[model samples]
Target: MRYSLAIMAIALGIGGAQAQVSPPLQVQEIGSFHVGGRVVALGDMPKREIIPSPGAPPIQMDPNGEFQVEQMYAQYIKLAEPRARYPLLLWHGGGLTGVTWETTPDGRPGWQIYFLRQGHDVYVSDAMERGRSGWARFPEIFASEPVFRSIGEGWDLFRVGPQSGWNPKAAQRRAFADTRFPLAAWDAFARQSVPRWTTTDSQIQAAYNEYVQKVCPCVIIVHSQGGNFAFNAALAAPDKVRAVIAIEPSGTPSAGTDASPLRGVPHLVVWGDHFADSPFWQKIRNNVERWAGAIRDMGGTADIMDLPADGLRGNSHMMMMDTNSDEVAGRIQAWMARRGLMR
Candidate 1:
């Protein structure tokens, strides 16, 4: 289905967010696609009744479970521009949906439009079991209950502010004074949260694999947990992946995995600030550096970008949502151009 620039902006908007930006857009085509998931026999639900008044007649709702299995949910937005060398596929991190690439909480345009206006055919997706994708029953289809994230954890884990003196009033109390993330949009950011499950990781991986196959020979831009997945995806099918750009990925493949798989595809890993305050991230950063070294040793192209060291500071895990997001995108675009990946 093709969507006009204005229509897409409206569809993705919440109450106050600005419309998507698509200027100088030479988009020849814009559409969506889905991959993964299987059909299943849906079970029936218990009946329920509603009464308008006490001791009055009641109305009942006995919904029938639609029979037949369905595919796993992973939605994709495809925007094609003749200027791009190849397609650009985006993958989101854990606990988030495709909205990660959508408008920022501050009502600003997202990377999706940023790249589109830059002349690349971009595909943004809702990973398996994410938004618009269907969910299964617990224990029956899903092996475990879905896990959730709290705003407090986000404030700390995302490095939006100091861990101490954190509360629902985080926006007013202690947001990093210099953080690019719009403090006023704290509530909007929280709305992007999604249920995450450890037990379904394999399924998620499979779904991602299917997605990669469907959109191969493309550059991948992934963030947080998506970082590792993008690497593995390239490793799993190097021919399908032209390059990979990981933004603060949460994990990586074991050292035992062959780095040669990705030797042909260029790799770029980027990190934001706040590692000094988060030990967990410090370890991850160290490991990523080491991994990059190992890949380089194997005659692979593995580059690193420490945003803070690069003179861009006060960024959080959600750096793309930071105030300097377009600047960052420009940096990546420059790199891609140097590599002859895009116009």
Candidate 2:
């Protein structure tokens, strides 16, 4: 069930206000469910009614369960004839939304618009819980189980075994225990709810087949954990995807697995140099490069981009949201242009 980027944009253009600088984004709850249940709404607010950010338009959601903001900016319509442009699917990292790809902290136009200006149709979204998209549904499922709850409580639980604790750790007694169960539950909920989160490698391939047959074959741009999902998806439909660009992707799904997906697709792996400072940086990078090499070895194009060792600071995970994000965006543009993906 694929929809054209143009149709999505128009549908999303209906109610949201413009963007603002300070709050940048505003999420309003138009409706709610039971206590401790989820709330259906316009923006990214948790409880309480959300206020619109100054200069930003109010967000809107349609009765069909489609989030308009994601459609409007992330999924773009071609300005010229549809045949003349390429389609691109952009996925952000964990805890972020499609808006993060389109707007900076100051609320000005961001990367999605940059790609739009370059003449490519794009679709972006908050993987699941980060943005105006459904938040409660996921939490409810994760909150149902204790093991899953622990997995969801901290970051990197999925990558490093759960024993790593909330901060970071080495191998543990059990991969499930090291991670917060709540977090795992959340991830499971996301996979079950999001159309893109296919449970098995074969399902991902099926999704690609459907996308290619229904929509224009697209270039997949994934950041962080999305890199994992996109890779698996591409592995499933190598013939349908044009290319893959991953930004600071997390390392998982060991390269040695016989089911190692992404065996024969053009791929670009971008990593923030700050990751070098982490104690586990070497192991993580090795895993990432090994996977990249595997893709290339299987006849897929693969490359890696390491951010300036000192240019972008803070946590390595924060590189995407850093003040110098434009630099990253520019590099992405260059990469796309080099691949002839940009129109």
Candidate 3:
């Protein structure tokens, strides 16, 4: 029960009206840490030539800068006065930043605030090489060029609807029809998508390991591509990670990988709807099922949540950005309490 008048008031979205919630968080701290090798030399790189005026021609500069910089960047916002036994750390999927946990595409609150209000110190991170964590030049630092996500890809992959066309309006229509994602905020969500480099996974995973080591005995909530990193983080430092909530993780520990480290640690694997209809997603579901079984065999408490099975249906791949996101967060909060992680 502490207050900070300068920063306490925040508007809460309930029933379409504004209600100010004072001190949504007791303490908020923001910072960053660099990782991996640094490039000491300034070098030439390609850029779009912009002509200033009719008489002034396009300018091409070579070896323009002279400063050392690192490729991996790790930024975080730590909220204090937590009611949970350990801090809750949120890791976003590929091509996204910590914004994934702060606001939905449709302009709703994200899980970061949800958990904070529930009395848990929270740490929302922008993983290395994404968002605030930066990237080095392709062919220089990265093995390949970064790949960008398109609206069609997002719609198909995120289970928003059958492949929408490339046009923004068409995608918007599809998103509206999907009824899972906040259609009005579809463009906003799309704006957050960024390029990602698969070649940098090792560096990214290493940074994740360091982050977990630096802040341990904490609960990790991971989404999409973040699932594997979070899973491995728990495995790498079993004594440090108390619980894991993998939301539709992209991959998992192989059946042969030893999950014994997770013994007595609560783990939850949550799945959204529309997977059975998609052959591609079905395989993913099958893989995670086996992985969960493997962890159980190794003496860990692993529970699975198939949203449709629980009567919550029509959820897209981006469940955190779905219309009923708060409902989903509520379920997760209850799960934490049931596991005794909540105070």
The candidate maximizing TM-score is: 1
After superposition, which runs of candidate 1 have C-alpha atoms over 4 Å from their true positions?
A: 1-24, 41-80, 170-172
All candidates: TM-score: 0.84, 0.55, 0.83
lDDT of 3 by residue, 1-343 (tens): 3344424333223322334344545666777665554555655665566676789978764544654433445555565556789888899998888889987776677887788788887787777777776666667657799889885577778777666433467433544343477766766788898888878777777788878878778999999899989888899998999999999998887668888888867899898887855798898878878888888998889899888899898888889989888899899999999999987
Model 3: pairs clashing at backbone N, Cα or C within 3 Å:
82-121, 83-119, 217-240
lDDT of predicted model 2: 0.50
Runs in model 3 lying further than 4 Å from the true structure: 1-24, 28-32, 35-80, 164-167, 175-178
Residues 210-324 of candidate 2: C-alpha lDDT, one tens digit per residue: 4444554788877766677677666656667778888767744555754334554568877664343355656767787888877677666787776655253332343444445
Report RMSD (Å) for each prediction in the order shown.
Answer: 6.1, 14.7, 4.9
Q: Is candidate 1 or candidate 3 better by TM-score?
A: 1
